[model samples]
Target: MITAADYEQLFAHAPCGYLITDEKWLITAANATFLAWTGYTSDDVVGTFLARMMPMGDRLLHTTRSVPQMQLTGTVSEVSLEIVDASGKPRAALLTATRSVNHDGGVEHRVIIFSAHERRRYELELVSARRRAEESEARSVRAEAGLQHLALHDSLTSLPNRAGLALILERGLTGRAPGASIAVLFVDLDHFKSVNDSLGHNAGDELLTVVAQRLSSTLSSAGTVARLAGDEFVVVEHVGSATDATVLAERLLEMVNRPLEIEGLEVVCSASIGIALADDESSEPEKLLRWADIAMYRAKARGRNTWEVHDPSEVDPAVNRMRLLGELRHGIEGGQLRVHYQPRMTIATSVISGVEALVRWEHPTRGLLQPAEFIDLAEESGLIRELGAWVLDAAVQQGAQWSRLGDGNAPVSIAVNLSARQLADPQLACMVQASLTRYGFDPSLLTLEITETALMENPVMARKVLTTLKALGVGLAIDDFGTGYASLTYLKEFPIDELKIDRSFVSGLGTSDGDCAIVSSCIQLAHAVGIRAVAEGVETDYQRSTLLTMGCDLAQGFHYSRPLAPELLEDWITAQPPSVASGRAAGPGPAHAEPDDDVEMLAAV
Candidate 1:
């Protein structure tokens, strides 16, 4: 509705400066506002390259960066620049530009400039204020002592994790009074795995969530409750005496003992509690956590739904460890350690592909102990090297014996776990070669499995070690594959033949969308890299079917069979069809063992 003259007036006197330039950035036209802002007449700016009016920093950005970008992309926006005015003073400006072709077939640029002096000053002031406030808050936080970060929180329960619990211990120790002591309570749920096995993992997760809420609400702010792992939680607080700690633990037991409705079923799950009190000012964090753990196990040993307090007047954990170490050395010499084999199946062919060797300690009085009970101890005490060697030699000898079964016997590979400590030794390859030679076992029939986390710890060193072992012609596998942060890049880099998907993800195959996607991607990734993908800890029929559909090459878990004595495994094999017994099964086994033991999940094998 406005006249042509009115439009002309608006362009000349617009709030921001406007200019037209040829492809070379030589100004062909400029609005009156542009000349006024620069304190220059038409004669001073017309026919001059825009770069000449910019400072060195902005000149380079305009010509070398912004101009080229606009020419290619057709636009550039909000580029902050410092321009030189007629008086040779620098002015802060925000620039926006666009490129187009004129009717005469020549390229032209339309440039818009906004004076940013006041806005830039305001932004600087705001940034300065923010930094000062942060500094003051940080100083106050430091005065209050160690505080756990939000990142330390668990994703599932929103409770603090193991690392956060350490910080809580630190802060608690720092503020303790003269003679007063602090207590760490270890809480472990009893028969928790039954919930998972019966109602599935979803119900198990719900029960855990409810328990976390109950514990947090019961303690309020008096104590800190942290989830150490699946069914383990730790409570840290200041207490006057051992008696007081006992009272607190009783309250906790009551809270956990209450029946709750999970998945439409009323479930009564109780906890065993272990309390460790440290009165010494110099007590280490590891000492307290370990003592609490040992006490918790004692409570479990006595019976569930009870509490036990660690008393130094009795056996010390460290002393007990040393004694146990000595006993283990004798146990090894006395032939007390036993090797059990868990069968692994070829998913596609239904063939009994191989068996993984799992070690068990026949601790005279302690009966049979799982690897979890003492593997960490052996590793820390530097005895794993000996333990590992024993397992390797024993497994190789056993494999050689099976190999002599002669014709029609399906060839079976024996897989042995290699601990991180063993992998670091320069002589590991030599030991492997020696074992193969002594037993006359086929190098191609032996598979060595290393955990993904262990391999990624010191990759350069792991690669050097793994390369040496690979030269011996044995297969290599990345155990617990999907649990750690390892990528396909490293997967391809390592000379591994198989990827064992971690059981944590496999368990959720029928329920968790995220887990299913991860499992599928892992299988595809392994296939793409020309490696076989295996799933570990598969229990349900649904999980097995899902993995089969995804083309998993191998699998092992309680769904097939628990690790058994050699003679028992032989019986199990004899019960199978002739095809299965010959390791050339034409179809899947008629049935696999489904165990009722709630503690089977805790077994590393």
Candidate 2:
């Protein structure tokens, strides 16, 4: 007869305090009673290492004694320890803990804290147990029920954990009307790691707490919402059809995608959802969770911030993802990687200002694969570091070769991308220095293009790494500028040389007045900061002309030349490009006299 409200009250007002921690001994959740006793708020402790809450001696005791005991036996007997209060005072308490594995494949522990003096009270109570049989029995029953409630609940969000979600799903399935069914929607927050990486774990926890509150409040009356683990949550509902569940899924995505401010930073994290419906045979909780998980991954793969419904007729992408990941590893090491260059034309002179090295995978069977196809794979598999290193080495070698060619018309520089993972590497500067020295490439001609997302993820670290790279006399560009919620403060502080306006705004040029304004502002912003403005994705004469008039310093897109193989790019360079704005050719090459046709084909498209 106990309801969720009853369990909440029980946990909040329990006679003893409680704390939960993940495998790493990081506090994940604490009950109100514990927070009150420790003079700390949930926010003060959650996402913080548990040892930090204790004094030096107690910390050592917990780490050396209690944690090992719990790990060996799944439980630790009451151990006397001193927990530090918010005021820097230590409070003596007895700790008893139990550890278990959650459905998400993570280990968690529940610790019940009791006052040290309570041990004496307990012995006294036992001495009078015969006289207070009824009282003791009632208390024992309540304590047992409290354990069940805590066991099934998530410490951080105070929502039903995985086990709790399974129980809810089971009840929904059995309690559904004869013709109705239960639906499970798996919601995974996108780019959450970036938030954590950039804003720190505290901010990530705050964001997760806010998100959990929103989802739970929105569905309080309709269905049950539970935290599955980390950034994943589940919503279970009783529905008549799949359409009903899917429609709800869309609304949930909107809720999750709305911009949020954690602490002082504004963040926008979208959710990719997967919905699964229960049938007569597949209505079990486990089956639905499995299917929904697979479908959620499908939503992510199809461009995140969307939803996907489980379709048995379709192939599960998990297996293919694994196979492709293996192939990509082979591609990088087995010589299937190719570096193509797209020319960057100076708007004023129409000269090939530089070339951005674009990586391609000449898969043994998949033909030529673009970055869009496997960049995420490489990123997720921790292979981006390896892949990026290879690209840097190859691009540097090629740039050095061209520099030696003495083709005064060849690109004056080459730009290479740095993934967030690569940027995070403490040794990134060293690696770049080694590569440049090995190739004997001019540091000035080796520009590094870092995405706004990557830079913003950890600006402090990015700045540190960038300062070192900048010291090497290489150009640093903020790639995909204006696409992320970047602070102008950091932009001004970061040691950057250029801002590459994202292609989206350029694509809308001459059509969307808003886009035109944004592009102009970006160019002006870059110029104001004494940095060149580069426009990406310019595909038409109109787009080109608008940017040129806007005083865009440089541009690269299909209007001039598509990204071509090294040899093809060399040919394009030798073909001589015309002064795009004046329709006059300048370089000493074969197409030096080629008149401007429809639009300036700087080289060959």
lDDT of 2 at 494: 93
Q: Give the TM-score of candidate 1.
A: 0.50
What are the clashing pairs of model 1? none
lDDT of 1: 0.80
| Cα shift from native, residue 72, model 1 (Å) | 99
TM-score of each: 0.50, 0.65
Q: Residues 488-568, candidate 1: write the lDDT tens digits.
A: 778878898777889999999989999999999998888888777788887877888899998887788888888877777
Worst 10 residues of 1 by lDDT: 594-603
lDDT string, candidate 2, 326-394, tens digits? 999988889999887887777766766666678888998879988889998889989999999998888
